[model samples]
Target: MKLTILGSQSPYNTTGHNCPGFFIQDNQTRLMLDCGSGSHSLLNYPNDLQNLSIILTHLHRDHYNDIYNLQYSSFVFHNQKRIEKPINIFLPSTPAKIYEDILSEQNSFAKYQIIDENSSFKIGNMNISFCPTDHPVETYSIKVQNGNRTIVYTSDSSFSAKNRLVEFAKGADLLICESSLLKEHGFPEINSHLTSEQAGIIAKEAGVKGLILNHFWPEEPVQKYVDEAKKVFQNVIPAIEGLTINIPSIEKELDERS
Candidate 1:
């Protein structure tokens, strides 16, 4: 399995940095975890569109705005006979107006699938599940597993004792968590976002192998987030655009032992 960071900037995009978007691929499947603004420019367009599936954590513009770009691209590809199938899109069915607007177009070239915390699905070799997050919107944190390796992505969310994030991320090989605020910026838990320290605490409690802090404010230094998270969890890094992390599959080892 390989995880690629397409964008990590939050709220809005900046020079060279886009909003939250990630691309994960394992074996035959190619999944776009989110399609935030400016992320479409990073994709391979018609080429990558083949066998592509996308999941939006919520209806926030920063998390899903580029979906329109993708929808347009899909339509063009289908018209040109460059692709035969519509892309599969998984998203929450809330904020009724936004959901209705997204699906209102009859000519759209994407297959929509409504998902919630109770949803679990498989795409190729990867199994995926979701857990509700502490965001104002109907957001969800995603978990994906393949060949005993697990990855959890915590979308925009706040920290709370009642949050199911730690349990959802428990024992994950990689925890891609949002570090949207700095501790000095005031109490983050009271807001709808997590601080760098909060992200670290979650990583420590979850016992994850590594933590990648993302969804940063454009003005802050990425190093700060990394440094703060390291205070709690040593094995932590800041998410960088275009960075690709390769997760080796353990299936071969199991096959050899068998």
Candidate 2:
């Protein structure tokens, strides 16, 4: 599998760091986990984004800023190539209306189909499942599996239930989670984020092969976050844009990489 982080910041980017964007691909599937700020430019407007067809996960401007851009661009791309297949979109029920607004979608947007909890779906080479996450907004976490290989993505949310994460992450070759805090830093108002320390606990307990933390504050040195996660997970890693990680199974990727 190939995991590429297109963006890895929290707030909308104005400087260098772009918000959150990730791409995952296996033998038969290519999925864009989240499309935050600058994603449209990253994909190159009017360019062939043909490698991607499946999209899933949370709702935050930093997570979906380019929805309209993708829609408009896809329309152009499809017409140029005489493409026929509609883009398959996997979305959380919580953000359907918001997504519609963002895309200015009439007739449920163009070239895309939204999948919710009420929907059971499949993409190439894998089966996917969504879980509710602890967050200020209604959010969804996801697990994708193919044979014994597994990958879990925690878009942006609190890790209040380590067991739940472990369930999704168990035996996963990779666990892409958010480490948005340092335990002592924030109060309860923070609601839906994890400190580096808590990030460690989840990775360790879940026994994931590798723990890659994203959606972090840029102010902290990468080493600090890595060190923090290492306390619980020996294979913990701080996320960086353009980083690529490949693990065999979501469960054991850390064991080999660390």
lDDT of each: 0.86, 0.68
| Per-residue lDDT of model 1, residues 1-258, tens digit only | 888888888889987898999999876579999888887778877888888999999999999999988988898899999988789999999998998888876666899999998999998899999999878889999999998899899998878732489999999988889999988887735678888888999989998888888999999999888888778887777777887778663233222321
Summarize candidate 2's per-residue lDDT along 62-124 as a digit string, tens digits: 888766666666666677764444455656545658866745664322555565544546677
Cα misplacement distance, residue 171 of candidate 2 (Å): 1.8
Q: Highest TM-score, which number?
A: 1
After TM-score superposition, the amount by which residue 31's alpha carbon in candidate 2 deviates from its true location, in angstroms, is 0.7
TM-score of model 1 (CA atoms)? 0.93
TM-score of each: 0.93, 0.85
Question: Candidate 1: which stretches are off by over 4 Å?
Answer: 161-163, 249-258
Best by lDDT: 1
Q: What is the lDDT of residue 71 in candidate 2?
A: 66
